[model samples]
Target: MAKESSHAVHAAGAHRVVVIVDENSNPFELGCATEIFGLRRPETGRDLYDFRLCSPEPRTLMRDGFFTLTGVAGLEAADAADTLIVPNRPDTDVPRRPAVLDAVRRAHARGARLVGFCSGAFTLAEAGVLDGRRATAHWQWADSFRARFPSVHLESDVLFVDDGDILTAAGSTAALDLGLHMVRRDYGAEIANSVSRRLVFAAHRDGGQRQFVERPMPDLPDESLAPVLAWAQERLDSPLTVSDLAARAAVSPATLHRRFRAQLGTTPLTWLTGERLALACRLIERGESRFEVVARRSGIGTAANLRTLMRRETGISPSAYKARFGPQTNG
Candidate 1:
């Protein structure tokens, strides 16, 4: 039979979590679900998610000729789920099965929260769940996704898009961020922090995937920009300029601008803005005593400047960012 069935064990009123895994699915995405919902965490004293792995077809799902997954629940399980998670699709261009699309539409109609990671946004888009809604996918597929789903508001610059019940994350690692955000939303910030500590990842990364994209590696033997970057990082509290950086690197200002454009895909000023924003985020996450101090340390100079830059980059004020990631103190 194409539809094999199973039930998710809803633990005495826990939300039912259904994750749809297809052939050639990457294990990292599956691991994200397992780590966030599958693992038993009695220490947190909160309601846990009852996770179910379902498939549209009955045959075993294989990855890399090893690690075969069997006994996947059927599409019917998705109808009963409180949350439906769609990991990256096998291929973004391939059309989703009609049965799968129908199931997804039904689940969303029933008020189930829909989540898509990376290329899986294609599935949601096909099901019309993301129509007229803001969404994101891996940067590499952003152009294709927008072209295919023209009705959806595609945001390629963000790490994730949380449109109430429908959430979509970008790339592989960004899925983890989305999962943690879900945990924080359902449980609380404390539980999310604990999970992050257990995983040994930063509680939150400020900005978006734009900060991590690969650029042409710099190509100077003796006058590399690494030393200049390191020096600038150490003196973020001081007002620094591109001319100062050029002088430090012992290169002319025009040469420095060319090197930044060629190697970083951005101008020196743009990169400096990102670096300053990154610093402010770190200080906020570390529980800085004052926003002014953080602003000074990040070279933003004033609290208003910090707010403007942070809002421009993350769509949130510095105080809100701090509240979400700052240290917790018990009274």
Candidate 2:
């Protein structure tokens, strides 16, 4: 994990987040926790989380003396955090202290949401928090993870799997995606989008982390589809189709379908509709104040269709969503 600098703002909010670390900790994953939950987002006019690092013991070297961390809180801190994160471990079979696993189990038993980043799935599995839950980890560790934890429904193809209270991220940076999703779930889309913009990260991703998984190269030379995706995004208000995408990419429809499946893990139409719906959500939250206008602008076809889609996707009407997440004015 590259060390990215972050600036803090006014601290606010009551949600407490604690990250659990061990001797074999991965710095990048630790950094992910600190970067996402620890930072104070001034743009939102308040800090999001009361974030800290907790260890079974005090202070340890991370990643073979890459750096030493000090002044870390102990397992008692996990008792107070609303969210508990276990960062990536160096090895799948590394011996873990019983106290660390006990702290994790106790944290989950008391209703703290448990999150495993990258190889941290191992720690969670050992703690038995993921026994019957849908979870995921970095692709490189999938086989070992599956072999060790047969009770877990391993979603090796996704960037992260969110099964309510138990969330697992695939790799180091996929933590960003999961963290943004948490913010969205806790605060609202408006706040999540603001944090993503400040980080200069993708506000929305097309598909799973399967695209990052290594595989044998196909016989045909594959060109990047990012440009075509960007072009489609610019004109999302207009109708888009598989044939249209093929033409834009200068490739046959069959080739486009194959590319979409291999690169994005979803069909082109699904990806396009997801993008359109994402836009609809943002526009609605930005105080659009009219479903008809938002639908037309987001290319969802009709206001009735927008209402149906919003209800089906979010279990809330457009009006209800706006009521909850629409622009806020500070008195």
Highest lDDT model number: 2
Instruction: Count clashing residue pairs per candidate.
Output: 0, 0
Task: Score each candidate by Cα lDDT.
Answer: 0.74, 0.78
Give the poorly placed runs of model 2, Cα more than 4 Å off.
1-12, 206-222, 261-266, 303-320, 328-331
Candidate 1: where are CA atoms >4 Å away? Answer: 1-12, 63-66, 206-211, 214-331
Model 2 gets an lDDT of 0.78
The best candidate by TM-score is: 2
TM-score of each model, in listed order: 0.63, 0.84
Instruction: For model 1, name the residue pairs that clash.
Output: none
Candidate 1: residue 113 Cα off by (Å): 0.6
